[model samples]
Target: MIRVSASGVNRPDVLQRKGAYPAPAGASDLPGLEVSGVVEGGDAAAMADAGLHIGQRVVALVSGGGYAQYCAAPAGQCLPAPEGWSDAEAASLPETVFTVWSNVFERGRLQAGETLLIQGGSSGIGVTAIQLAKAAGATVIVTAGSDAKCAACLALGADHAINYRSQDFAAEVLRLTDNRGVDVVLDMVAGDYVEKEVGVLAEDGRLVIIAVQGGVQSAINAGLVLRKRLTITGSTLRARSVAFKSALAKACQAAVWPWIAQGKVKPVLYRTFAAGDAAQAHALMESNAHIGKIVLTWGDV
Candidate 1:
């Protein structure tokens, strides 16, 4: 067992709570993907047998059941918490960091000096992607719904922040890139943006879609994709197998954890609510006014 200090609230959690994403066989019905806590008992002996400390502070990715005082997780999914970091900050890292690292770097094959256009720039995944891409020497462009949200993305090292509500993102992206277009487009808006995303892709550009918040189905321009040699792919972290998530966790620890520890990257926490107020926390996430992460804190910490 582990004492959950903080649990990050994400969109899937809200979806699960609302009966959108059903819990898999034998998984917890509670809606949480990541958590921070101290090891207490149960698997503690097993972890120790594998050379892990019993009372060590750690952060982990869970498929479900994170919004409680105690969460049972496999030891393989855990990583040591950055020294001196708050539980809220540690709690915020696993989901966003792992998602960004996997989708933006490993799968998208985004390289240094390339230009990346990120949708939903103020979101947990967006904020984390902006920081990581910028740190790795990429030019980052982001789209958000409000001026304040755009400014927040810019403050987090985005080279350009477009207010999607005020301007056409595709036109703005084209203007910013001088028609050459971006090397990668990390999109969460999958409705009408699909054709536009394809239109804005550079030669051999990769478009990785991680969510469909706008709408699920959209018509695509096959001609634009064929002409641009674009590649479009999408993934969800929650439905992935344990081995995949464990590999992702290891990759995140190797690539981004050091930067976090050195203060080059940090968790952007929007708000914190008590564990009992999980419903309120999910409601806050649904509001879409938060800049980064919303967390539910548990225990005395």
Candidate 2:
């Protein structure tokens, strides 16, 4: 158990609230998948392996039930806060870090010197991906809805940003990559985007979809997928086994956590609301006007 200090606001929480996305069987019914605070108690072996002890400041990726003063998380899913990070900053890391590590790095197999086209560059996942990819020596290209968002993505180490509302992202990606296209695409919008995304891939490029914000159904040219030998896949961070999350946690502690400590990557905090104002925080997230992340503080801490 963790005495919750802060929790991150995520789209899934909103979806769950609206009864669109239900919690997996045996998971908490409450919304929120991540939190940060002092460790209260848990498995000793798991805690020790995670470099955690009783009363230690740590961040955890919970299965659910993070929007309160206390949350129980898998012991293996916890890690000490990055040096000098605030509770809010630490709180913001788990969901995005875990998602990007699982989908972008693990599933997509994004490597050094590759180019990544992130669909929602100013989003929580997008910001985390941009920083991590850049730190790993990959070129980052992002598409946002407005010029301001484009600028924000650029400032966060993206090589190029396309205002999708005004410019065609596939065309811009081609132009930016000298017509070769990106090596990977982190897509949040599926449906029709699957076809357009397929058009902007280099040979053997990978497309990892982590959300279906646009729509669920899609019609794609299998010929494009076959001819290019592209790989299109996706996964949800939650609903996975504890062992899987534990492995991912270890991987992040090894690969991504160092980047955080070295200042190569940092949390991008947009606004933090008091826990009572969770509705307002969700409103901001749904508005798509805020860049980076929105967090909710649990109490006086």
Candidate 3:
């Protein structure tokens, strides 16, 4: 268990707030995916195997109950918070880090000498993808709603950012790649964008869809899948087996945590609200005005 000091508010939380997504069985009905706090207690043997001790500062990925003052977490899901980082900053790590590592690298098979196109480049997931992909030596192209958001992606080390409001992302991506197309696409907009993503992928490319923000139904050309040997896949982090998540947690700890320690990848937090103002935080997330992660703090510095 953790004495929760801060909670990361994410897109799923917003979706749950609107009655769109439901919490999984045995999870708290409260809306939260990640938290940062002190490890007050847990199964001692599990904690020992995970190298965790009582009073250790940690950021944990949980199925639910992160919004509470205290929450039970699988010991393996808790990672030590980086030294000198605040609760708000540490709270931002788990969900995005785990998602990007599992989807973009594990499933999408993103390589060093490849290009990745990300839809919704200004989102929490988008920012994390840009940094992680760049750190792993991949060229990133992102599509944002505005030029300012595009600039934000560029500043975050994205090789190119397309303003989807003005330019056709598919055409721009094809043009930017000199008609070769990108090696992967990280798409949150799955409906109409799926067809276009199909159009702009290089042979043997991958498409990892984490969310369907643009509606679940998608129409894509089947011929492209056969001709290019494209791999279109997706996964939801919640409802996965503890063994799977524990493995992912170990992966992030081994690969990404070192990046965090060296400053290659930092928490990209846009804002924080008091725990009581969680509704306001959710509102800002829905508005899409923030550039990175949002958090709710319960007085932790």
Candidate 4:
């Protein structure tokens, strides 16, 4: 058995908990995606069955069932915790890193020196995207609802942090880029932002939508897309096949893991609650007041 130290709370967890996102066939009903822990006492076979070992510290992605004393996960999804990192820090990595890598880099094809705009700038995915894009030599812009959130994004290496509530993000983006527009738009707010995102996309720009927090349906401008040759696509990580996720996890391990080990990338944690307080943690995420990730710690870890 493995002892869980910390579990990251995500929107899918909240959705699963509320019955909005139903568990797939043969999946557990528990609500957690990523966790950090140490193996206690289990046979090598059992440990291998769970993709772990006795006394080894690890971080893993779980389909569900993460908010418990002992959680089981496939060994392929687990990675050794970086040396000297806290369980909370290690626990924070998998979900956001996987999501961002799959959506922004793999799908969006964000390239060096490209201009990228990320919505929800203070979110876990937003912070990680900013750092990664900047580190990869891209000019990163972010949009948040509050000035403090904008400042936090700027602090996290965003080139421009726009207050979505105070200004028109598309206009701000246009102004910031001298009307040439951005090369990629990493959007989570899919409602009315669709039109605006298309408006600010440069020639051959890629808009990758990862969430629909505002609303899903929207009117689009086909002419604009055709004129600019923009590509609009979106994806979710949880529903993907294990092989796909494993590939993403492996790619992330190779590209971003070294940076994390060297402190070039750091996990941004907003608050950590106990596992029993998962309901409250979900409530906090819904409030959208957090600047980074909200995690649930198991025991003192």
Estimate TM-scores for all models.
0.96, 0.98, 0.98, 0.94
C-alpha-based local distance difference test score of model 4: 0.86
Badly placed stretches (over 4 Å) of model 1 are 42-51
What is the descending lDDT order? 3, 2, 1, 4
Q: Return whichever of 1 and 3 wins on lDDT.
A: 3
Task: Compose the digit string of candidate 4's lDDT tens values, residues 73-95.
Answer: 76667778888788888888888
Which stretches of candidate 3 lie above 4 Å from their native place?
none
Model 4 clash pairs are 51-75
lDDT of 1 at 182: 96
- Write the number of the candidate with greater TM-score, choosing between 1 and 2: 2
Candidate 1 collision pairs = none
Give one digit per residue, the lDDT tens place, for model 3 in 1-301.
9999899999999898889889999889899999999999889899999999999999999998888889899999999998878999999989999999999999999999899999988889999999999999999999999999999999999999999999999999999999999999999889899999999999999999999878889888999999999999999999998889999999999989888888889888999999989989989998889998999999843
What C-alpha lDDT do the candidate models reach, one value each?
0.88, 0.92, 0.93, 0.86
> What value of lDDT does candidate 1 attain over all alpha carbons?
0.88
What shift in Å separates residue 72 of candidate 1 from its native position after superposition? 1.0
RMSD of each: 1.6, 1.1, 1.1, 2.2
Q: Model 4 off-target regions past 4 Å?
A: 40-52
